[model samples]
Target: MDSVYTDVGQARKAVEQHLARACAWVDMGGVLLVVSELVTNAQRHARGQWQLRVQAERHRVRVEVSDSVPLPPRWRPGKLDGSGGWGLRIAEQCADTLEVLTSARGKTMRAQWLHPGRTGVAVA
Candidate 1:
C-alpha cells in the first residue's frame, strides 16, 4: 500500500496469498476486482496515502482500502459508452457487501465477498 501508485497486481497477489494461507475458497476473481476498484478510486481521488487491507475470516474475505480523502465517493452508475468508467458499479454487483466509512483522518472503502457456492454468485 504505497502512496505513489495503486498497483492492482500487488493487491491481487497479497489477497491471493492470504487466502491460500488460510485455505479459504472464496471468489478470488471478485475479491481481486473489488480490490482493483477500491485502489483505483483511492489513487484517483484521495490526496494522501492509500492503504489496502485484506482479511480472511472463517467464511468471508473482507477487503478495505483506506485513503486520506474524507469525502465519500460519488457512487456513479455504470456508463454505457464503453469508455471504461464502471469500477464501482461492477464492485457493487459482484461483492456481497460494499461500504464506505469515515474517520478522523480519512475515509475507508470496504468490500466483502463470500464463496460462490454459498451466495450463488456464479462468477467463475
Candidate 2:
C-alpha cells in the first residue's frame, strides 16, 4: 500500500488500517509506534508532505516513509523530562532492521520486521 499525507493524524490512521488488513499477526503497537515516529519526523523536520508505503508478506512487513528532506534523522539520547529525543531509538528497538536512503530530492526511511521464527533471509 502506498499513500501520501500532509497531516500526521491521517498518516497514523492509514497505518492502522493497513495493519488491520494486511499485518494482523504483527505487533500492532510496535508498528504504530514506528510509523508515528517516522511520520512525525517528516512533518516536523521536513515541514512538508510525506509518503508512506507498507508491504506485508506472510513472514514480514516493511514500512517506508519518504519526505522531501535529504538529510537523515539523528539518534539522540533519551531525555528524562520527556522534552524530546527518543523516537529513533524506540523505532530501532521495535524494527528488525531500519535503513535510511537519501537523495537530492528526498529521503526514505525503511523499517522492516520479521514474524517470529522467520529468519532474515530470502527463501527463493
lDDT of each: 0.77, 0.82
Q: Using lDDT, give the best candidate's number.
A: 2
Error of 2 at 31 (Å): 0.1
Candidates in order: C-alpha RMSD to true structure: 4.7, 2.5
Query: Residue 34 of candidate 2: its Cα lDDT?
Result: 95
- Per-residue lDDT over 1-124 for candidate 2, one digit per residue giving the tens place of the 0 to 100 score: 2334246677677778877898788988898899988887776778757888888888989989988889888777889997778888888999988899999999999999888878756732
Candidate 2 Cα RMSD after full superposition onto the native fold (Å): 2.5
Instruction: Return the lDDT, model 1, position 108.
Output: 89
Q: What lDDT would candidate 2 get against the real structure?
A: 0.82
TM-score of each: 0.80, 0.85
lDDT by residue (tens digit), candidate 1, 1-124 = 5646547778778778887887457777777888888887887778646899887766677888998888888866667896556888888887898888997788988888775556754421
Model 1 TM-score? Answer: 0.80
